[model samples]
Target: ILHVTLTERRKEYEKAKERDAELRNLRDTAKLQEFFLQEIQLGELWLARGEHKKSIEHLTNAIAVCTDPNKLIEVLEDTLPPHVFEMLVHSIPYTLQV
Candidate 1:
């Protein structure tokens, strides 16, 4: 009986922790959205001005913070010049948020 009670308590504790984390993420959503937008805009601006290296840096940062990097990459691929998109792919870190 004691073992079963302890197991149940542990599960409840884990669920509570997950809920708290979700709440914290929700609170930070606005800040994250702003940052993501800034990075993407800066990247696009630099790319338009023919600054390949700077554009790659900003785009890589955007990808790193993105929750859905695959979708973002698809959009970028469709929008960016092929060579520039290739550069971004190479520069993007393996440790993406997604």
Candidate 2:
């Protein structure tokens, strides 16, 4: 379900002008808030594109910079699929572990 949707959207986004613009705009922004959302969106894009490592990189960065728990939760919920979500869910504790 979500697999097909994200992959298809990835393809469409690859051809989308707005997607590129958003990517570029977000990357250029220096503010943490702006960068975090852009990074999350970019992570989704990368994940959809089957670039898991890149996706993780951006998603991790997003998680690090997020000041609002609600917004962070929203991105976590919306960006990840079952398998990816499961992996991330397990990794959360380790990520936070000192």
Candidate 3:
């Protein structure tokens, strides 16, 4: 079920990218959101696959683009197990503290 949801989100991300290109002159939050969503989805997928390093990479990317750390934390809490979230926090300690 999660895989299916992720796949659907991936499709939405692709479409969003196309729309972003077409509306390049416009300043929109959708682009950032799409990138964030994609990164988070990839991070979760890697986590589920036991690829902690790759998961951290994608999660870091997501964090880099995020405007709200608290919101990101909320999403992470909902999506990732507590231990995995702790690992991610430790991996990017400085970034999270910022």
Candidate that beats the other on TM-score, 1 or 3, i.e. the better one: 1
Which parts of model 2 have CA positions greater than 4 angstroms off? 1-30, 93-98
Residue 61 of model 2 has an lDDT of 70
Model 1: which ten-residue window has the lowest total lDDT? 89-98
- Give the best candidate by lDDT: 1
- Candidate that scores best on TM-score: 1
Error of 2 at 85 (Å): 1.1
| CA shift of 93, model 3, Å | 3.6
Per-candidate TM-scores read 0.68, 0.52, 0.58
Judged by lDDT against the true structure, how good is candidate 2?
0.73
Question: C-alpha displacement of 82 in model 2, angstroms?
Answer: 0.8
Shift of residue 32 alpha carbon in model 2, Å: 1.0
lDDT of each: 0.89, 0.73, 0.83
The residue ranges of model 3 lying beyond 4 angstroms of the native Cα positions read 1-29, 94-98
Taking the tens digit of each residue's C-alpha lDDT, what string does model 2 give over 52-86? Answer: 77777677677766677547756677757866766
List, residue by residue over 1-96, the lDDT tens digit for candidate 3: 999999999999999999988788454677788988999899989998999888988998898788886688777878787888887777676655
- Clash count for each candidate, listed in order shown: 0, 0, 0
Can you list the residue pairs that collide in candidate 2?
none
